[model samples]
Target chain A: MYEAALTLYGEAGWAGFSLDAVARRARVGKAGLYSRWGSKERLIVDALAAWIPPRPSGGGPGPLREELIRLATAIFDSYFDPVGLVYLRAQLEAMIYPDLFGQALERLQRERIRLGRAIVLRAVERGELPEGTSPALVLDSVSGILSNHVLSTPASQRRALLGRRDEYVEQTVDFVLSAVGYRAQGRDGLLSL
Target chain B: MYEAALTLYGEAGWAGFSLDAVARRARVGKAGLYSRWGSKERLIVDALAAWIPPRPSGGGPGPLREELIRLATAIFDSYFDPVGLVYLRAQLEAMIYPDLFGQALERLQRERIRLGRAIVLRAVERGELPEGTSPALVLDSVSGILSNHVLSTPASQRRALLGRRDEYVEQTVDFVLSAVGYRAQGRDGLLSL
Candidate 1:
């Protein structure tokens, strides 16, 4: 039912998205939807939360750069997914219905920031990042670059870029680290400066 | 009339936007709109073209980094303006009405890329950038970062950031230059590496 709601929202956008349409698409009774989610706003918030992947556990067993690459790759995957389209629609809707859609978007951004802060803090603790590095700035730069790349590239050409996902991820990770003052060591060595 | 059409489009979105609404908003007869634009698609194309600022007359008289800061500032201003919000709406509308909106978007993007390519080519000629730097890549990175920052930041907080526009432009110019391997000489100095 949630999936159906998202699809309807994506296709119809805010102006056209309706409980009736969602019910029709999901092939469920209006009473069932009302009972489960209570309101469209509640349903949207819950559905978005469900779609968002939890932050990875343990940060894996890799160097800071490698771990960052993994985190970036995961973020890229989620943003390029169909659910991402729904989120984009929600972003547009926020312009019109800030109280409803804005709250949902704020929650999502906060969660992403929390997860990103944890990753950066772990790197700092491991002596990878500088002690006073701003987690918010780092996360924004990394996510902004990735999101911009995806949004600017037309859907038809995205497959070609995604085909070289590892190269893309590596370069982006390197770029972020470099921007934050991490200097690479000799070839194939971990970042030192 | 064009401004009226865009206003209606922004408010109603593509689904609800119509010749009638535009005519009503502009206080003009429907016959005049029909005769002038011939079709809704033609009207949209004309409106978008009118809204987009023409490329700068010249790259301006400054070092490559300074020129880029100016250009980035111009782009950021246009993007954060109300017309920019209308353009963003058109972008989302492109997904649903691809044939109509896609052609309009293609024209706009082509014009922007052409202008960006010209700026980068000039920098390369002056030995500021690498001989083989990809203009498209540079332009995308700069614009993407700016657009994403504006879009992600909520409206309430945008004023604080906009108040420091020069700093934002300077930092973004530095980041893009650095990402492409241009190193700054020193504090308040030209790029050397």
Candidate 2:
């Protein structure tokens, strides 16, 4: 049902999103949807929670560039998926419906933001980044680069983008690392530096 | 009429966009809208064209950092305006309706992208950047950075973001310049560099 909801929402803007439409797409009865979600907001919240990629499980901090590369790769790849529409839509809604959508998105993003912060913080601890480095700025740059690249690419060139995803991800990560003056430590892609 | 169209589209997304709604908003007759634009696509094209910022006129390129700061400031400011919603919606729609929306957006973006390219290209020619610096990457980084920063900012903290707008713009531009190994030339903000 959640997948069906996202797929429908992805194809149609908010205009086309309807309980009847979602139920039909999910091949379920209207009663079930009503009983499951009393309101469109509740249904959207639940569907987005379910559809969002799982946060990384507990793991010791890895090298900075590698972690960022992984993060950049994931963000870049997700934009090419159907979820991109949902992401973009949620971002738009957050602008207009700040009270409702803002709280929901903040709740969803809290943990994800923490992970990115922790990675940079760990790097700072390891002396890879200078003291007083802004984790928000660093993480935002990686994400922005990937998001803007995919969003700006012409439709005809998406396949070309996909083919160069790895290269692009590395370049983005490298750019941010250089901007922050990241120092090469024991292990990571930047070791040769 | 165009203002009404963009205002409606910005607030409501594609779902709420219609000739009837626009005519009502503009206090104009439906016949005028209908006669002016036979289809939503036509109306959307004209409305966006009217809404988009005009390309810079015939100024020879200024200092690289100064020019980028102006561009960054403009892009950043636009997101704070109502037009951000329209921009985000168009980006989302382009993903789903690539055949129709893609061509339209491509036509619109070509000139804007060209200007960013020219700025970087001129800098390179002036010996401010490396010979092989990728104009697409440099320009994309600036735009992506600004776009993501605004989109990620939460509602409660918007005023804080606003208070530091100039500072943030310089930080963002400086970060990109540092990453790309930009050389400071005469008459730019980077003279202090």
Candidate 3:
């Protein structure tokens, strides 16, 4: 049912999206949807919460850079997923209906930030990052780059970028490391420092 | 007239956006709009081209970091403007009507990339960035960060960030400089490094 809702919303943005259409697509009666979710906005909020990838656990038992690379790769993969694309399209509704959409998106962003800060804090404890490095700033830099690429790039080009996901993650992680005043050490693939 | 079009489009989005509404808002007849642009899409493209800020011509006669800071600040300001909000709303239409919106957006992105590359080239020539630094990559990093912040952050928080635009630009510039293997050498305001 949630999948049906996502497909409908993705196909027709907020303006065209309708509860009736969702019911038709899901092959369920209107009463069924209404009983479960009560309102279209509530349904969307629940769908997005279920769809968003779980916050990544901290990189386990690896070098800080390696752990960061793993986390970045996971983030990039989840964002590039088809379901993630649907969530992004739905998020655009915030521009038109901030009260309806902002709550769900704000909650999601808070979780993402909290998870990102934890990763950075773990690195600091391991003596990898500088003592005063701002986790919020670092996470913003990394996530901002990924979100920009996903949202702005043309569809054809986006597919190609997704194909090179590993390289993209590595470069982004390297950029994040650099932003925090850490010179990544190694000559692997495109990053040579 | 373009401002009217932007306002209607921003308020109603692409699906609800209508030539008739634009004509009503601008207090012009349908024939006048048709004779000028021949189609709604053409008018939108023209309006955006006129509204988007001209590419910053890299701060002349200043340090490379200073030049980048200027360029970044300009890009940030343009994106947060009312007209820019309209463009961001229209961009979401691409997810639903790819063929209709994609053509205009692809052209705009190309021009933006070309201008960004020019800025990075100037910095490399002035010995600010490493010789092998990729201009496209660097521009993507800078523009991506700016776009992400504008599109994703909530309205109230976005206002707060805009209030500190200079500080934000400095940190972003510092991040980009670091990404390209250069350490910024100034400690004014928020940038402690």
Candidate 4:
């Protein structure tokens, strides 16, 4: 039922999406929907939580190079999902409507920074990255690159962009990993010696 | 006179900035200002041209590495100038108020991308970067990283961020340069590898 609401929200944006529309899509009673998620904000928040990738695994004794790519790929893939895109757009809009959106946007960015820092920190500890690199800054740069790609508009351009997302992501990951002094196996394909 | 007006606009924001304030700061007659620039918007447009950095003198020679640093530093330095900050903020607001700001921003971004592409293209020709690296993607990532720095507010926080900006810019430059297959400069001091 919640996933149905997310689909409707993603299709129509916040203004066009309706509880009845969600209920109709879900084949569930309106009363049950409200009981499960009390409001639109609540529902959207839940949907975002549902959409975020679960904590990445394969940490123990894993190859630092491969694990970093796995981490980056999982992070990149999350943006490919429809619900993730919708939540992102909604958050961007909230930035402009600060009275209503500022707190939520702040929370989201802080959470992102925190999660990103952890990933960088772990990579450093595992000898996959340099010692003094600030996890926060790398997180900011990587997130900035990925978010820039995702937020580009004019739906027609998105297909070309989608085709190129892997290249951009791979290039960006290579950039960040290299900045932290990580030596990944496959970048030679892109880096050309 | 124009620079004073731009600085006022940046400090006060659009609603708060006034022609009288500009006149006061410039120590110029309002009549002279009105005769030249016409209005606030026109004044801002003119200031944008005047305040942009004069293109550097490296010409067709020198390492692409040093030229890229100069380019990024020019941008980072401008953020400290009051008028430059105002221009940056106004452009961001104008993104949502396109009818008011018109095509100036679109044109500006295109010009910036062109400049970036020129530098990257030069690198490829020099065999300093990979053949297939998309100049457009590289430029977009550059903008994203710089814009992320600009939009990060809470003046104190932004100040703290400045301390890290050099490191951040260095990493971003390294990222782009390496992603394009630039030969790794042994012991490139910033990355601490």
Candidate 5:
């Protein structure tokens, strides 16, 4: 039932989302939907958390740059996944109609942010990043670069992006670490004065 | 007719977008729409280029950091604008149905990238940014950061995001510059050795 609901939402966004449609698509009586999830908003909020792609994970302790690379690689590669669009649709719509997509997405962002912050905080504890580095800005840069790069790339050239994924991820991670004053750990491109 | 097409696309996405619906919304005869556009794809391609919110402009050359802040600020503020949805809808859907949205959106991105690259190149020539700097990476960081930051920010705290808009832009611009090794003229928060 939830799968049916998300498929419908992804196909048309809020304008086409409804309880009736989900019921019809799922081949279930409308009554079941009404009793379980009274409103389309409620149904969608419940459906979205499971359908969105995985964000950067909070892996066990490791080098800060390696940890960020692992996290960013997850974010960068997720955009190419089918579930990624479901995430994108919910996020874009939530901006337009916060009342509908607000609660569900907030939980998701807050959770991912906590994970990201912990990673950065650990790095600071190990003297990798500066004392005042912001996890929001740090993670936001990686997410933004990958998201914007993919979305803005011409479809004709999309295949080329997949080819460069590893290199792109490495460069991005290194660039970010370098900017935050992390000393080079044997990488060649650290910017010098 | 174009206005109606964009409005409908923004509301329901591609699922509810069609020539018949657009004709009804515009109060125009279906035959007229069919005769003019022949397909919804054509109409959307014709319409979207105009309705998208303004992208970061290639204003005449100036300091790299100031130019970047101006451009990033435009992108950050745009997500709050009504027209921003049109841009978002087209971008997300384009990833799913590239054949439909490829050409029109490709032109928009390509042109903006060219302008952005030009901005970075001029700065390098003037000794503001390093000669080896990748303009694509430089501009992509600014654009990507702004896009992701806005999309991930919860709608409930949207007002707070707006309140911190200027400070956010400065931080992002300075962060990108400092990462790329640009010396701070007078800014205090630069990442230092």
Candidate 6:
């Protein structure tokens, strides 16, 4: 039922996707949906929960740079998935509405930031980042970069760039690591999955 | 007339603003707007154009890092101006509605990319950045970070951050320069600013 709701949301946006539509898509009765999820907001949130990629263990890396590249790829691919575009637009547009949709987006951003803090903390423990570096700031910057890429870059351009994900991550990691006083030129590029 | 249209667009969204409303706000007939801009789209485009801050002159600076911080602060403050948020949200939302928005957004992104390229290219000429760094890539990442700061951070947080804009820019410049094999540490931090 939740999957049906997300798919409908992805196709029609929040305004367009009616509860009846979700019932039809899910092949369930309206009463069942109402009984199970209580509201459209809960339905959407539950769908999102089911769709989110599981946290990957950042183990098996030769170096922190390599591990980071591997991690970033998973993150980007999941968030920017083509199926996720509508939800992305919905979430961004939610900022204006500031009701149900807005609350949904706020939750997502907080979760993302928390996850980002964990990543930064891991990097610090591994001695990949400089001491005294603010993980929140670094997360903010990195998240900003990736978000801009998805939101601003043309889809065609993004596809081409994704093909060269290794190169992009390599240069990015090099620049990031270098800026933070960890010279890992030897890592030099993406660590393949 | 253009000023009136910009204010309307800022108050209402692209969908909400209209030619009649613009004429009403300007206290001018609809014909006057049609004569000047030919269409609603063109009018809004010109309005955005009118709001853009002039790019910083490259002549005055100690190094690329110093100049970049100066330029960034100027750009940041300009975009954060009261009307700027409306323009930004409108522009971003337009990208999602490709057919309705036309090529205005594409042109805007290109213009932004071009400005970024100019800054980085000048830095290269001055030997502040590495020889082979792609100007486009660097600009993309830099712009990405800046865009994220604007979109994600709330206004109060932004005001707080702007108060310490010097420190933020110093940290950014310090990191970028160090990563790119330019100057290090004290040279790029707030004391120099």
Candidate topping TM-score: 2
- Better candidate by DockQ, 2 or 3: 2
Please write out the lDDT profile of model 5 over residues B1-193, one tens digit for every residue: 8888877777668877889999999998999899988988889999976654575566655777778877888888777755656777887788778888888888888887888889888877766677888888888888888888888888888899899999989988888887776753333434323
**Chain B TM-score for the candidates in order:** 0.82, 0.89, 0.76, 0.75, 0.84, 0.73
DockQ of each: 0.34, 0.58, 0.34, 0.10, 0.63, 0.24
Give, for candidate 3 chain A, the lowest lDDT window spanning 10 residues.
A183-192
Q: Tens digits of per-residue lDDT for model 2 on B70-108?
A: 888877877766665666577667777777677767756
Q: Interface RMSD of the predictions, in order shown?
A: 3.1, 1.8, 3.2, 7.9, 1.5, 4.6
Give the clash total for candidate 2: 0
True contacts kept of 5: 0.76
Model 6 chain A: lowest-lDDT 10 consecutive positions:
A184-193
DockQ of 1: 0.34
lDDT of 6 by residue, B1-193 (tens): 7667766665455655678888998898888777877777778777765555345555574467666777666656645443544545454445445544435555666676777777677766655667776765555455556655544554235458778877766666565555556632244442332
Model 5 residue runs over 4 Å out of place are A20-31, A49-59, A183-193, B20-31, B49-59, B183-193
True interface contacts reproduced, per candidate: 0.19, 0.52, 0.29, 0.12, 0.76, 0.28
TM-score of chain A of each: 0.79, 0.88, 0.77, 0.68, 0.82, 0.72
Per-residue lDDT over B1-193 for candidate 3, one digit per residue giving the tens place of the 0 to 100 score: 8888877766656655667878999999999898988888888777766655434654474465777777777667756454555655555566456677676677666666676677677666656667877776776677667766655676447668878888888888777777677543343413224
User: Candidate 1's residue-wise lDDT over A1-193, tens digit each?
Assistant: 7788777666656656667778998888899888887777788777766666434445564466777887778767755554446666666566566677777677665666677788787777666778887786676667667765655555355569889888887877787787776543434555455
Question: How would you encode candidate 6's per-residue C-alpha lDDT over A1-193 as one tens digit per residue?
Answer: 7667766665445545567789998788899788887777778766765665334455774466666667656645644443455445444445444455555555555666677667666766656666676665665455555655555565335568778876765666556655555534234443332
Q: Which stretches of candidate 4 lie over 4 Å from their true place?
A: A1-112, A119-134, A146-193, B35-38, B49-51, B54-60, B146-168, B184-193
Answer with 1 or 5, whichever has the higher TM-score: 5
lDDT of 2 by residue, A1-193 (tens): 8888887776775656788888998899999899889777788778876666633333356678778877777777666566556766766677777875677677556666777789989899887899999988898888888888788787788789999899988988888888888897765535446
What docking class should model 4 receive?
A: incorrect
Judged by DockQ cut-offs, the docking class of candidate 2 is medium
Root-mean-square deviation (CA) per prediction: 4.4, 3.2, 5.5, 10.1, 4.7, 6.4
Candidate 4 at B186: error in angstroms?
Answer: 13
Give model 2's TM-score versus the native structure.
0.88
The predicted structure with the larger TM-score, 2 or 5, is 2
User: lDDT per model, in order?
Assistant: 0.69, 0.77, 0.68, 0.59, 0.79, 0.59
| Recovered native contacts, candidate 3 | 0.29
